[model samples]
Target: MTIDTALPVAAVMAAVPVRDAAVAKRFYERLLGATPDDSPMPGLRQWNLGDGVLQVMVDPERAGGGLATLMLDDLAAAAEGVRVRGVSLDIAQGEVVTAVARVVDPDGNAITLVQA
Candidate 1:
């Protein structure tokens, strides 16, 4: 039961449940402006999100059951990009002066973009 904080940890993958993997894949590609890194399994798509991996998979029972918050270098630019792709965002209040914009995927999974 001892932990080693000094050891390097492996990358983390955030999973987002979707009703239709194909639809989610297209939405995410437009939203992130990149194709999936790989599809290790059927009905599963993975994207490299800098610090971590974003996995979108089909799971009828758990569709729309996850939330991810991404920190961006420029909030305005990111918002505009998504907007151009026909994605609407809700600019909400943040804890500090940071700007936060939120959007939901086809399956209703929430993705929040933040700029500090």
Candidate 2:
């Protein structure tokens, strides 16, 4: 089938599956430094990160099997923030030109924070 050229498409939220919604909510709140902006429905929590939305949803089947990457202004500062929250970041590799850090959530979901 031919695609429509007049249609408009835009990127939306990224869903990260978690075992428990409540627990994940608290973890994300601490990481983002703010409470969830909205919870559209049960088992789903969302945070507005300026350009896009990050959704933490309860999904036992796929929990701990998700991955998300966040591009930040300062990787060091962000890593420090995570450490302050009692969360350790796994520094898989660091490039002098572009700093990057990896962290796993309570449910084992991988999150890569990169300095841009």
Candidate 3:
């Protein structure tokens, strides 16, 4: 079997589902160490990272069902930055990546950081 297709995605905006926007925003703000760069609609908040965006949206039934991974040049520094901002995460060695750490938002959504 053969198929021809094209994915011309210019950029990506990951949507993180949450139960409470306010609470989730606060948690993400600290974890990312900045306020949201945009909010396109109610119950939604976004942060621009590099060439992409990460957004949190309110969805009670879908809360805690989101996950995103971020690759960084310095995993230790990134982990330390979040920790100092009041987000607790533990770093560990992994085969796929040099170092990795994970943190969960108040609503249970997780964001994984890895050394690239």
> Which model is ahead, 1 or 2, in terms of TM-score?
1
List TM-scores for all candidates, in order: 0.86, 0.83, 0.92
lDDT of 3 by residue, 7-91 (tens): 8789888889999989998999999899999999999999999888998999999999899987789988877898899888899
Better of 1 and 3 by TM-score: 3
Cα deviation of 34, candidate 2, in Å: 1.4
Which candidate achieves the best TM-score against the true structure? 3
Model 1 weakest lDDT span, ten residues long: 88-97
**What residue pairs clash in candidate 3, if any at all?**
none
Which scores better on TM-score, 2 or 3? 3
Per-residue alpha-carbon lDDT of candidate 1 for residues 1-116, written as tens digits (9 for 90 to 100):
98888969677788999998779988999999889999999999999887898899889999988898788888887878888987877776688847899888988899888987
Report model 1's TM-score to 2 decimal places: 0.86
**What is the overall TM-score of model 2 with all chains considered together?**
0.83
RMSD values for the candidates in order, in angstroms, are 2.5, 3.2, 2.5
Clashes of 2: 0
Q: How would you order the candidates by lDDT, starting with the best? A: 3, 1, 2
Cα lDDT tens digits, model 2, 33-99, are 7899999999999898868889999999999998888878877777788788777765544655377
